[model samples]
Target: MLIGEVARHSGVSARMLRHYDALGLVRPTGRTVGGYREYSAEDVRRVFHVESLRSLGLSLKQIGRALQDPGFTPSALVSDLIRWTEDRLERERELLERLRAIDASAPTGWRDVLRIVELMQGLDSASAARRQQAVLARSEGVPAPADVLAGAVLAESDPHVAGALRWALARSDGDGMATLAAGARSEDADIRRRAVLAIAEMPETPGAAAMLADALRDADTRVRGHAALALGRRGVTAAVPVLVGMVVEGSNDVEAAEVLGTLARDHGCADRVVSALVAELDAPTADSATRICLTQALFELSVATAREVLRRLASDDDRAVALVASAFVGELDGRSAGDRGARVRSASGRRKPRR
Candidate 1:
């Protein structure tokens, strides 16, 4: 077959066929009467073979080696192509995400677009300070998209950056509550911990509350403690037990106790709060130190029932427990005396100087 005929039949452009011939990849077997290059059947088949390899992302050099070198194998070259394609795909995905973030920001002009893009890039920077600055910059103007802030908060390791991201997320119109909730479910403990902590900072939306409730059951103590503390502040009674357990474990025990004390102010939950603390205090597994921490945590409670419980604990069998409880009780008594004295003086002063 003539080169034109092969080009017509094989669909390979004549120009490319000439280039292939020049490269010795598919030399025609003979010349026609007019001196046109005539392609033999085998040469036409090689043209199809090269096109087939090119379709799989092979470079011309690789294709040439694949067809000419007896030792050349498709496996290694195919693997390389796969890796290159994956890398390209990853880059494309990142680009798409940035574009989406910019779109989500609804930038008013190119400057807004540039600022948001810069912020997004900074959020992904290796330097924590850069990431922190990005979040800080977000508050100054051109806020980051909700998804960007959510992603940054989840992956952020620096406490300051995480705080700024959380603050930005709370202000962004994007719906990142779901993202944070998913992070709460991550198998990575750090991600779960960060997720719950971020959710804790979000406004007390129903979704945020529900996510926090789910986090209360997380296996990680820190994750649960954070969720419980947030929920406790929101007055969710379900967090009471976990907060009490935090006191027992001595992990963020002080904050947990503070939450528990706050919960104890609610008349409905005060009994439950005081009872949980009393149970832990009375448990055989609670060592002397654990009991002492629990005793101190009781000071956070203002409920009369908790005070009565403290009075009873002040005479417990363990001298250390008794001492801590007695000291707290003494402090409480001293504060009450001062409060009464202040009230009396204020009342006397309100008597209009008898003039």
Candidate 2:
């Protein structure tokens, strides 16, 4: 076959075939009377083989050596190719993430696109301060898109930067916070912890409450703890049990107790909160420290049950717990005296004076 016929059959352009010949990669083993390049059957087969290697990302120089050097081992070259391909794939993935971030910004033109890209770079910066400023610095008070913030919130490892990212997300329209729900379910516990923390701050998102509700059951203590605290602060009664557990565990138990008190404003939910705390105090496994924490948690409740429990605990066997309970009793008494004084003054003022 002539070069033209070989080019047509092999889909390798004629010029490329000539270049291959010059490179000694696939020189045709024939020539016509006119001195035009001619290809034998074996030469055509070599052309296809070169093209196949090229498809596998082999350089022309590498292809030349592989086809010509009988001593060349493919193992080392194949390993190099694998590493190169992986690096290329990783670069492509980063580029794709950058593009997606820009697209999610919903930029009106190239300027907005550049700004978003710059912010993304800042978020990825090695400096934690730069990353925080990236999330906080507004383009004339226009925050980064919530979706962009959501992505950063999940990827950020620095506690300060992560807090900034979450604040940015919370300040946005909150619609994009939906993207964080997937992170909440991530197999990585750290990611799930981050997701729950971010989601906890975005309770206004459409399903934010339900997402948090689901997170309350997460196996991670931090995940469940954050979820419960957020839910309890929002007056969600379902968080009562987890909040109570957090009190026993002393994991942000003070905040948990405060939230429980907030949830306890509802008479029905108040009973459950009080009962759960009292039960933990009564558990045989409850040590003195746990009892003290529980006693403090009881002080958060407004119900007579909690105060009565505190009074009983004020005389309990453990001196430390008894002292904390006794202090709460005194504090409660002080509050009662203040309340009575305020009421008497108001009633005295309401009365018709001598005038």
Candidate 3:
């Protein structure tokens, strides 16, 4: 086949074919007697492979090396490409986070605006111009036509803007929550916090559970507290055990108590949590707040088991326990003749049988 035929079959321009030949990357099978380049079907296939690799962001040199190695597999090459893409995306995320922090800390200013405009101009030459344009246009007060022209310029020249746009698309339209969850493991506190918040706002999917659980154990008390609150808001019942553990064993008992209260009310896990709380009360080191929280959770439980647990706690020697137990007795007094008599007997036992 002639060079034109190879170009047509491979979807590579004739000029690129000549360039490939010049670079000794993919030589034609033979030359015609009249000195025109001639390529075989094998050459056309090689050209397609080259184009595919190029599309995957491989350099011509890299493609040439892969072509020379018979052991190279597309899967291995794609694995390398994926690693490269992820690294690039990580860097882009870091940059965007920095930009967000800067935006949040300082009032918008001419210098910042100039810097953003310059960044946009740099991206105008990349594949993500249209997306960057859309993001810029959404900001307040930039007229539509000016935003378009500015975005076009940024898309053409700025690699960062292009990379950011690519990352945004991959994040928003693809597995963004998964990516953000991975980010949550970063040693940086800000990254972890941002990752948690980002994942919390994402569409609720089953995959999000593990991340929320991790956030519940985060070293930052505020982050852990927020994660628990968010999970409760989502009514993620699967998180009940973790939330209960936080209530029972948290370093910040007040925060844990508040989160547990919210979980009891919002996530419908009051029964399970009340049971854990009652068990905690029997442990000698339990704090007054834990006892109070337990009693409150029992009230929320409003079940036969709750009544039994409260009666047991009320019989304890601790005054705080007695007070909460008395409240539980009063609340249960009107339920039924059997329940009322049982509570009266339990209260009589706690009062030394009124001797």
Candidate 4:
């Protein structure tokens, strides 16, 4: 076959085939009277072979060596090709993500595009300060897309920066709630924790509350605790049981207790919250330390019902529980007496004649 025929038969273009011949990768075997290049069957086969290797991302120089060097081992070259392909694919994927983020941001101009890109880079920066600054700048000016903030929030290891990122996501359009919700179900406990924390700060979007509700059942104690705290703060009484469990476990038990107190302030949920706490305290299987933590958790509740319960607990059989409960009751009594004394003194002073 001639060059044109070879180019027609195979997908390789004529110019590329000639270039391959000059590179000695697939030289023609014969020439016509007009001195035009002519390819034998074996030469055409070599052309196809070169095209095959090229398809595998082999450079022309590498292909030349691969074709001509009998000592050349394809294993090493193939491995290298795989690595190079992976790198290119990664780069392409990153570029695609950047484009998608930009599109989602709906940048009004090149300046807006540049700002978003810069903010994204800063969010991904190794320096936590830069990440924090990025979130601040984005919040103050061009808000980053929720997806970008979501990604940053999940991967951020720094507490400060992660807080800022969550704030930014909450302050943004809130389209990233789905990403955060998916992250709440992540197999990684750390990621799940981060997701819940971020979502906890988000506006109570329809799906966010449900995601947090699901997270209350997570196997990770931290995840469950965060979800419970968030739910309690949101006045979701469904969190009462988990909040009680957190008090039993002594994980953020103070905050859990405080949130439970807030829930108890509601006349409807108040009895339920007190009942759950007392039930945990009443469990026979609860260890001494757990019982002690539960006793301490009672201090956050100042209602008359809680005081009566603490008075009953003050004389309990467990020495540690009795100590904590008695101390709490004593503190409450002292504060109460001090308030009464102040009121009486003010009344007496008012009743006295001015000098």
C-alpha local distance difference test of each model? 0.86, 0.86, 0.64, 0.87
- Angstrom error of the Cα, residue 324, model 1: value is 0.4
- Candidate of highest TM-score: 2
In candidate 2, which residue pairs get closer than 3 Å at backbone N, Cα or C atoms, i.e. clash? none
- Which residue pairs show backbone clashes in model 1? none
What does the lDDT come to for candidate 2? Answer: 0.86
**Residue-wise C-alpha lDDT for candidate 2, range 1-355, written one tens digit per residue:** 9888887899999999989988899988878999988888888889998999999999999999999999999999999999999999999998987787667667788888778788888887889999999877858544477777887888889999899888788877534655688898889989988988988877476788988999999999999999998888777888889989999998999899888887787636877888888888889999999989888888988778888999998899999998999999999989999999999999999999796
lDDT of 3 by residue, 121-239 (tens): 43443446554655444443421222223223222334444344433433332344545655678786655665665556556656776788778878876567557766866766655
Indicate whether candidate 1 or candidate 2 has the larger TM-score: 2
Off by over 4 Å in 2: 141-143, 353-355
By TM-score, the candidates rank as 2, 1, 4, 3
Q: What is the TM-score of each candidate against the true structure?
A: 0.91, 0.94, 0.42, 0.90
**Candidate 4 runs further than 4 Å off:** 139-141, 334-355
Q: Report, for all candidates in order, the number of backbone clashes.
A: 0, 0, 15, 0
- TM-score of candidate 1 versus the correct structure, residues matched by position: 0.91
Each candidate's root-mean-square deviation in Å? 2.5, 1.8, 14.7, 3.2
